[model samples]
Target chain A: MKLATIRHGATTTAAVAVNGGYLPLPARNLSELLGTPEWKHLVRVATSSHSSPDVIPRTEATLLNPVPAPAKVICCGLNYADHILEMGRDLPEYPTLFAKFADTLTDPDAEITSEHSQSLDWEAELAVIVGTTLRDADEAEAAAAIAGYTVANDVSMRDWQSRTLQWFQGKAFDATTPLGPVMVTPDELDPEAGVQVICTLNGEEVQRGNTMTLVFSCARLLSYISTFTTLRPGDVVLTGTPGGVGMGMVPQRFLRDGDLLRTEIPGIGTLTNTVRIRTRATIQSV
Target chain B: MKLATIRHGATTTAAVAVNGGYLPLPARNLSELLGTPEWKHLVRVATSSHSSPDVIPRTEATLLNPVPAPAKVICCGLNYADHILEMGRDLPEYPTLFAKFADTLTDPDAEITSEHSQSLDWEAELAVIVGTTLRDADEAEAAAAIAGYTVANDVSMRDWQSRTLQWFQGKAFDATTPLGPVMVTPDELDPEAGVQVICTLNGEEVQRGNTMTLVFSCARLLSYISTFTTLRPGDVVLTGTPGGVGMGMVPQRFLRDGDLLRTEIPGIGTLTNTVRIRTRATIQSV
Candidate 1:
């Protein structure tokens, strides 16, 4: 089953994709639905009845991020061996974790402004959405905690990221994380198996790699992170991206205004965003 | 007037601190009360009714974090001139911004376990709680955005913090940010004026400094941070701590099992937490 968050009027509504259409769920947001077992059961029922005429057309509706306002947006660093080598870093002995706040989140179609940052770059990553509250879960338990998978563009500012010891300063600029067209449940694809993840700028492929390169699998990541903190129902874990980030390029290709960024994972969906520079007056106007 | 979140039964209630006690507010949490015109009115009423009989005894109930789940928890790095010198780094040209998820938050008397980390440390910081939604606000507008002030202990793990270029991993361990006892409204204290802030370990003074040591004032920090992203109601801006972090000590004093951490500020309240180490069985048990 594919789940999504769609904008209906001024508010966001939980939805499930079915036969080229979307069925609005009786919930407010993904986080609220995640807290109830009944919601998951209802999603299965809704997906089974997708062919019925009661389904709403997916078109003519605006799509929001699949996992909006997650309690925690956790990210991993150097999970891919090739990417580790590209940045001249050693293979990490343990999974490196970081976080992005809800304010930095943006929808797939949202604009990523390059304001105050001239070295914006893109990293294509596979994001796992948590279904249940998990803490100190073992391997099997961690595997069961995963709800679905989605695509994310870990847009970063290279200059800012390198300025300090903490990468969050550079990684959490406004509208930095472009996430989701839809969330594809594990039944749709093998959660452990590798899948193709790619990124393109202005219709030109800039980064291409496979999830098979991940040094730490999803289960290990979930388990490792839970050791330090409790994983909430609506938390998101972004498995590290494979090689081919803009920083890996010889000349270091940075995102510029009007650059179209397309990030995708095979079974999930595509997340496309355009870069724009925010001016001081324009920012003040918001 | 001061504000706090109280757990009454299964629900979290927002309360106004009155003389010698508190008065329950109409809101559920600080986040819900922010940005409401009625909140300002409530503040006025609460201030005038400080000595009223309706005020409830604070000892009769539990006090939770002032802002349990803020829209964003923005943190600054080495923003104090003394801290910069202690860390042996040059002064920063801009306000360094990073973030922590809402899940990392806990109340004033909450227990903070450093089981997963062997080098946990404590940082006493003055946090600015946002009252209004602010984006690219000028200095004046930034000052207007402040709703109140609170004391926070930004607990960290040095090893995890230095694991990557991003400090989020070490900064966001579960139950790390123990905030509040009360949030003193702007009318009660001048944020720009320096205030005494201190921290102690096991009843021994470890840090003592004034907000005057801050390289950037509260107004400048808020205005600068808003340039990178939108500051929403109930959002918190943690102005950086001073030079006496445990990691900066000559012999390096990391938190160990049974260590008691107490942090306090002048107008705001004090927070106390005890640390416990994580064991293998403990990880499996959870």
Candidate 2:
């Protein structure tokens, strides 16, 4: 089963994909929908109902970030063993975690813009959405709490990132991170069994790695995070990107204005965003 | 005028500190009140009213964290020049910033506990609260947007903090950071002229520093942050701690269970929290 936050005309709503259309749920978006304990039952009922009167055709609706209002948007760094080895670092015993605000997330196909930094880069990742409250949860409990998985590009600005020891400033620019075309439930998609996380620049493939090489699995990452902070419904945890980011390229290529970036996780979905870089003088007053 | 989120019996309301009492506002807390553009007008009208029918006597109400639902809680690190020099690092060109969650905050007088970490440390700091929407704002605009000032202790778990390069895990434990007895509006308190930030552990002074020596002032920090992310009303920004944290001591001293920790900024109030560290064997399942 897949879930999405669909924008049809002026209103946006939490919706389930059914019969090649979207069946709107009661809440405003997926984040609010996930907060209720009866969300699954509601979705089940909606899917089984005979009425098709309210279902909107897929083409008429636009998909926004599946979970937009997550209170905590935590991202892990260097979880892929291959990526770690290439960067001359050992597989870390603990995940190097940082945070992003809900303001940082944009719609799946939104235009990504930056004015402060010229070195824009891409990192394709698999993002986990929590469905239940979790604190000090063991691996199994964390696994049971999984809501779904989606695709994201942990878009970064190398100039700002290298300014300080922290990566937050570079990674947290508003609307820079594109998340979700749709979220695929764990029952239908399993990263442990291996799913391809792929990234493309324009029309050319640049990154291709399997989730099997992730040093910290989804459950382990969630459990580790729960030890320090509670994971509530709709909270997002972005697993570190697989190998082959622009920063690691031999010539160090970066996204230029008008460059098209696409992030894909086979079972989940893909996010296609165009990069827009505005220089200081030409920067809009926003 | 001072504002606080006061709990009287089973209910909580945003209240104005009046003639030795609290006059209730319409919102549930300061965060909600600040979001409305007419908060100042509303407070003014409430204060000018002759009748005091709804004012809760000071002793009858308990104060929670004044702004409880800030979407962004960004913190600056190593901002004091003196602390930076003592740490053997030159003055940084940019502030080292990090993010914390709303869950990390607690009532000013709450007991702080750590079950996963043995090295509990305290960082006494002055916190800034945003009163309006700010995006790509200048220093003057950022300064004008200040809602008020408050006292906060960025309580950290040194053990968890040292596990990875990022300080987020250690800094983001739920209900560890104590954030206010009340919020003093900017007109009543000024950090530019210098405000002493003092910390005491078990009634003994351990840290003291003046905010005038800060490398990046509150306005500057907010300005820099607004360049990347939009800071909305009720968002928080901690202006970093001074020298003399437990980790910086010659022979490091950590907080033990039942130790009284106090953080004070003269014009604002003080936060009095009791330290409680639980061992793994005794850790509660919550």
Candidate 3:
């Protein structure tokens, strides 16, 4: 089942993507939909009923990130062994975790602005969306709590990220990170079995890896994360990206003003974002 | 003017602390109050008229963290030179910033439970609350955006914190960090000039420093943070702590099951939380 959030003028609402069209759901957004206890049953009923009331063609409706304002956005760092070796670093024993606020999220097709940084890089990743609230969860509990999976590009600013020991400031630029086209249910998409995740620069393939290559599995990461903080229904865990970031390139290539970044996972979908460098006037005015 | 949030049964609401009493505001919480355009003026109107039809005395009203659910809780790491030196690190060129989710926050007088950690540590910090939204803001703009100042203890689980290179996991435990008794407006509290910040364990003065020693001032940090993400009302920045945490002490002291942790700033009120180690059942049950 594919669930998405589609924008309608001033408001965004959760909708079921069906046969190249969106059947608008009563819920405001995927975050709100997941918070409800009987979301699965509710979505099933909405999916089966013919009276969608307002079905928008997929191409016309603006698709946003499945979970626009998640309660928590926990990102994993150094989870890919290939990426680690490429960067000339040893594989870490534990998953290096970090945080990104909700404001950092942008639409799937939104323009990525290079305002504070010109050295923008792209990292293709598989994202896990939580369905149920879990705390101190075991492996089975973590597995049971899985709602679905999506695609994301952990767009990073190399300069600001390396300005200090922490990677948050650089990685957390507002509306810089592109997420989603839709979320595919876990029954339909199992990243553990090795799904191809790819990134392209202007239709040229740059990054390629299998989700099975992750150092930590989704269940293990979620269980570990739940040890400290409660994983809410709409919380998202971005499994770290594989190799082929701009930083690891031969000449350290970066995204130019008009560069297009396309992030894709076969079972999920694609996110195409155009990089736009903001001028001095536009920088301070935002 | 002082404002607070007080718990009534399971729900909490915004309040004004006046004349040693709490006047329940119409808004849901301090976050909601600050989100309004003219909160200061509205609060003033609520304060002077004496029509606090639902007033609760400060003693009887159970105060929660003033900002119960901020959109973002950005914690600055190693801001003070003394603490940075004590921790065997050089002064950083940029402020070390990390994040804590809203779940990590606990009430000022709530029991500070040591769930998975016996090596609980304390970091006394002055907190800045944002009142308006701003992006790429100047120092003057940053100064104007500050709504107030408060007290917080960045309680840390050292064992988990040092598990990886990043400190997020160890720092963000459910309801671990203590914040707020009340929020003092910036007109009353200026952390730049040097305000006394202290942390005591069972009445033993362990950590002591002044805000004057902070490498990054409030305005500077706000300005720096604005470069990437917009600072919205109800967002909080927990300025990094000063020296003398349990992690920095000789012989390495830690929190016991029944230790009293008190965090205080001169202008802002005190936060006294009793440390209680979570039982085996309580650990997995939450």
Candidate 4:
């Protein structure tokens, strides 16, 4: 099953993707919907009968970030072996972690703009959402708490990122990370078996890797994180991106004023966002 | 004026510290109070007429962490000039920043326990609270937006921190960081002129530094951060600690079970937290 937070006219709602439309759920967004303990049962009941009047046409709805108000949005760095090797680092015994607030997330098709950074880069990743609370969980228990998977582009500002030892300042620019076209349930998609995580820049393929090559799988990462912090329902954990980032190129590459960035996963859908780099002059005028 | 979230029996309320008691505000906590646009006006009106029946005696109230639900909890690393020099690094041109979640916070007098780490350490510092929304703000604007100042101990797990380049995981253990006894408004306690940030272990003093020596002032840090992220009312920013953390000691010290850790800022108040380290055996038994 595919789930989404969609905007229609003046309001947004948690909806289930139907044949050619969306069936509205009870809550305003997926974040609120997941907060309820019986969300799965509610989703089951809502989808049981999607009457003609209850379903909104797909063309009339605009998909938003599925879980926008997560208490935590954690990201793993150097999880992909190929990416680690490219950066000349040894495989890590523990995952390198960082954080971003809910404000950092943007709609699937929104424009990602930044004026403070000149080195804009891209990291296409598969994000996992938590279905249940987890603390000090083992790998098996972590797997059982899986809610679903979505697509995200970890858009970064390299200039600000390189200014300090921590990557948070650069990665946390408001509305930089584009998330969700739809969340695919774990029962339908298995990242462990394999799934291609792909990224394209202005129609040119830049990154392509399989989840099978991840140094830390989704469940393992969740278990490790829960050792110190609690993972509640609606929280997001982004699996690290694969190799072939622009930062690793011969001369390096950055997004221009109007570059189109697309991130996609086979089971999940694609996020189409246009990059808008505001120059200092443009900022001063505003 | 000193503001706090005081617990009376099972409920908590945002209150102002009056003569021998607290005058209750309209909101449940400081976080909620700060969210309203007319909070200052409300505080003014409430304090003007604090009848005996409306005031809760000081002895009857227990103080919890103020600003419990900040959307963002950003922290600075290596901000004090003396601390930076002690670590053999030059003053950074930009502040090194990281993040913590609301769950990382506990009451000022709460017990801080950890079962996953053995290298628990303490960092005493001043914490700044945002009073208004700020985006791309100048230093002057940022300064004017400060709601108040409080005390915090950035408790850390050195073992986990050293496992990766990022400091987030180590600093983000649930309920490890102790924040607040009370919030001292800008007019009352000024960090720029200098405020003594002191820390003691057991009964011996370990660290004492003045905020005047901060490499990045509170206003400067806020201004820099606002360039990339939007900081709203009730958000928190913890300035880095002074020179004498357990990790910076000659023999390298760590907290043990039943150790009393006290963090104090003269005009503000002190946080008395007992450190409880849970061994693997103790965890297994539970």
Candidate 5:
């Protein structure tokens, strides 16, 4: 089943996309819905009622992040062997983990702006969204913890990232992570299977990779990160992107104003964003 | 007035600390209270009703982070002149900003642990908690955005921090930031005035500094960070720590098992933590 959050009127409402439309769930957000045991019941009901007329039209609403304002968002670095090789860096002995605060999250179609440095880059990744809170989780437990999957564009500022040893400084600028059109639950798709993840600039494909190239599997990465910190319900794990980052290209390809970035993954749906460069006066005034 | 979050039964409740006791507020957490326009009214009521017998006593409660899962927790690097001098680095041309996920936050008396690295360190900093949602705020507006001040110990793992260019890997381990015994409102204390901030190891004073030595004042730091991201209600800014971090000492001092860290500021209350090192098997199994 595909789940999502949509802006109804004054506030956001939990939803489940069905047949070409969205059905509002009887919950506040994705976190609350997952916390209740009703998800399993809902899944059972959904299968049998697949042909029911309870579906709401999707054109009447605005989409939000599937799990807006999660407790944690863990991101991996250099997890793709081909990407690692392209950067002239050795394969990491252990998964390199980092974090993105909830505030950095935005809807897939949201606009991103960065004036501090104009060297913005795009990375298309398959994001795993956790369904249950799991700490010290084993592989099997990690698998059970996963609720669904989504697409994310890990937008970064190259200059700010290289300025310090920590990528977080450059990685966590406000509205940097564009997540979700909808969350595709594990029952609907096998997360371990490779999917064609692609990043397109305007109308042309610039990045093409598959989850099959990831050095660490979803379960292993989740378990590894849980050892360092707790993973709460609604938290997301962005498995690292494959080779075609704007920074790795010849002469470099940084994001500029009016550039549209569309990232898609099979079964997970598409994430679209537009780039807007901050003006000098706006930068200084801020 | 000072604010805090006390876990009562299953839910967390907001409270205002006064005299020798705490007065329970009608809000769930600091963020909720700040989001309401009645916050100033609530403060007035809390202050006037301090001596009223109707004020209930908080019983058997566990204190949570004063901010209670903020929108973001922005941290600065090398914002103190003395700290920059000690680290053999020049003063930053701009405030170096980084972030800590909400999961890294622990209560005042929580335990800090490390699994990947053994060389852990402690940094006592004056944390500014935003009272109002702010974007593109000027210095004056930034000062107005501040809700209160608290004591935070920004724990670090030296091995991960120094081994790479990005300090985030080491700076953001689980339970790395212990924030608050209570938040002292701006009306209660002047952050610019010299307020003795101290950190004691076991029972001996190992670090002593003053907010007066901060290279960028709270207003400037807040204003500078706003340029990068929107500062929302309950968002916290960890102004840089002064010199005397364990890493800056002769031969260097690092945290080990059974070590106790007690950090305090003049107006704000104290925070105590115990450090524990995780075993290899324990680390892997998690």
Candidate 6:
């Protein structure tokens, strides 16, 4: 079953996607819904409806990122073998971890506005959302903690990222990263068995790889992060992206005004976002 | 005027530090208080009068970290010149920023409980709390954005930190970083001119430096960070630490059970936290 956080007019809430329509769940957002002890059971009830109100036609509904203000948005770097080599780095013995805040999140269809850099780049990734609260969790416990999967484009500012040793400044511009079309449950996905993850800009395929090639799988990353901090419901983990970034291109095709970014994973869905360079007037007005 | 978040039993709220006792403020936390449009005016009134029912005595108050869950907790990697030299690194032109979550924060006087690594290290820093929202702020705007200053120990687990290319894993263990006793208003400080920052373990001075020697001043950091993200009320900016981390020591002294970590700034009060190693039995019970 596919779950999403959607809006109609001013009201936003979690819902189940079905038959080109939405079945509204009785929760404020995906995070709050996942926080309940009976979330799994609730989702079961949702799939088998008790006359769920057709909240809105899915086409007319405005979909928000599943977990907008997650407790944490942990990201891994250099996890994809080809991507690692493309960037001229070795397959790391350990995950190179970093973070992004809630302010950095933009909706699936939102426009990417660059106020800091002209070198905005894209990294398409298969993302994970945690469901249970676990600390010092072993591999099995970590596996049991899986809530679902989603899509994200880790839109980055190449100039800022490379300026300092730490990549945070370049990666965390407000409302820059796109994080969801919908969340597909783990039972519907075997990403570790090689699910295709692809990125395209202006109808040209730039990045293509399989999750099976991930140096560190989702379960291992979760268990490793849990060793240091508690992994709670609504926390997001962005598994690293594959190769073919614009930075690795010969002339370096950076994002410009009106560039289209499309990311797709077959079982989950597609995310289409247009890039718009904030004009001098538009920037000054804010 | 000094503002604090104090807990007595189950309840916690923003309060004014009066003579020997605290006066409860209308806001729930420092974040909410700072969010008000007339915060400066409100604080002016708070400092003057009203028969405020006596809250906890200042000395007896059970203070929590001033901002329990800020929108962001950004930490600097290397800002102090002398300390930067001690760490065997050249001066950086830009601030090396990283992140920590609310889960990693503990009360000022709380015990440092570690369930993971034994190579815990100390990094004493002067912390800034943002009061107003700003984006691409200039120097003057940055100065106005300052809410106040406080003390923090960016305690790290060196083993976990060095295991990976990124430093986040080791820096973000749950309940490790100590953030506040109270927030001292900017009107009371000359941070740019420098304020003495000292760190002592078991009453022996292990690290000492002045905020004046910071490679990036507080106002400059605020302005620089505002370029990428909005600086909201209660967001914390840890201005990095001076040199003298345990890793730089001759034999490398690491934190152990019963070790006392004390941090002090002349304008801000002192923070004393004791370290404890959680046993395996205690870890599993949770």
Mind giving the per-residue lDDT tens digits that candidate 4 earns over B79-167?
99988887778899889999999999999999999897888999998999999999999999999999999999999999888788998
Which residue pairs in candidate 1 collide?
A165-B165, A166-B165, A166-B166, A166-B167, A167-B165, A167-B166, B115-B278
Each candidate: chain B TM-score: 0.93, 0.96, 0.94, 0.97, 0.92, 0.94
Compare the candidates by lDDT and give the number of the best one: 4
Model 3 iRMS = 4.6
lDDT of all predictions: 0.81, 0.91, 0.87, 0.93, 0.80, 0.86
Q: Write the per-residue lDDT of candidate 4 for residues A116-196, one digit (tens) a residue.
A: 777889999999999999999999999999899999998988877878899898799999999999989999999999999
Per-model DockQ: 0.45, 0.59, 0.56, 0.61, 0.41, 0.54
**TM-score, first chain, each model:** 0.93, 0.97, 0.94, 0.97, 0.92, 0.95
For model 2, how does the per-residue alpha-carbon lDDT over A1-286 read when each residue is reduced to its tens digit?
A: 9999999999999999989699999898999999989999989988888377889899998999999999999999998987887667888988999999898999999999888888889999999999999998999999999999999899998877877778888889999999999988999999999999999999899888888888889999899899989999999999998888888878888899999999989877889999988875443221
**Candidate 3 clashing pairs, residues 3+ apart or interchain:** none
**10 residues in a row with least lDDT, candidate 3 chain A:** A277-286
The stretch of ten residues in a row with the least summed lDDT in candidate 1 chain B is: B277-286
Please report the TM-score between candidate 1 and the true structure: 0.91
Over the true interface residues, superposed, what is the Cα RMSD of model 1?
4.9
Stretches > 4 Å off in candidate 6: A50-55, A279-286, B52-55, B278-286
Q: TM-score for all predictions?
A: 0.91, 0.97, 0.95, 0.98, 0.89, 0.94
Where in model 5 is the C-alpha error above 4 Å?
Answer: A6-13, A57-63, A113-117, A187-191, A278-286, B6-13, B49-64, B111-117, B159-165, B277-286
Docking class of 2: medium
**Model 1, span A151-179: residue lDDT tens:** 89889878767766667767777778998
Interface RMSD of each: 4.9, 4.3, 4.6, 4.7, 3.7, 5.4
Task: Show the lowest summed lDDT stretch of 10 residues, model 5 chain A.
Answer: A277-286
iRMS of candidate 2, Å: 4.3
Candidate 5: docking tier: acceptable
What DockQ score does model 5 reach against the true complex? 0.41
lDDT for each residue of candidate 3 in B1-286, tens digit (9 for 90 to 100): 7788888666678988877588877788898899889988888888888654567766678878999779899989999999999999999888888999888998999998876777789899999999999798898999999999989999998877887778888899989988998888888888887899999999999989999999989988999898988889999999999999998989898888899999999878899999997654343311
Off by over 4 Å in 4: A280-286, B280-286
Please tell me which predicted candidate would have the highest TM-score against the true structure: 4
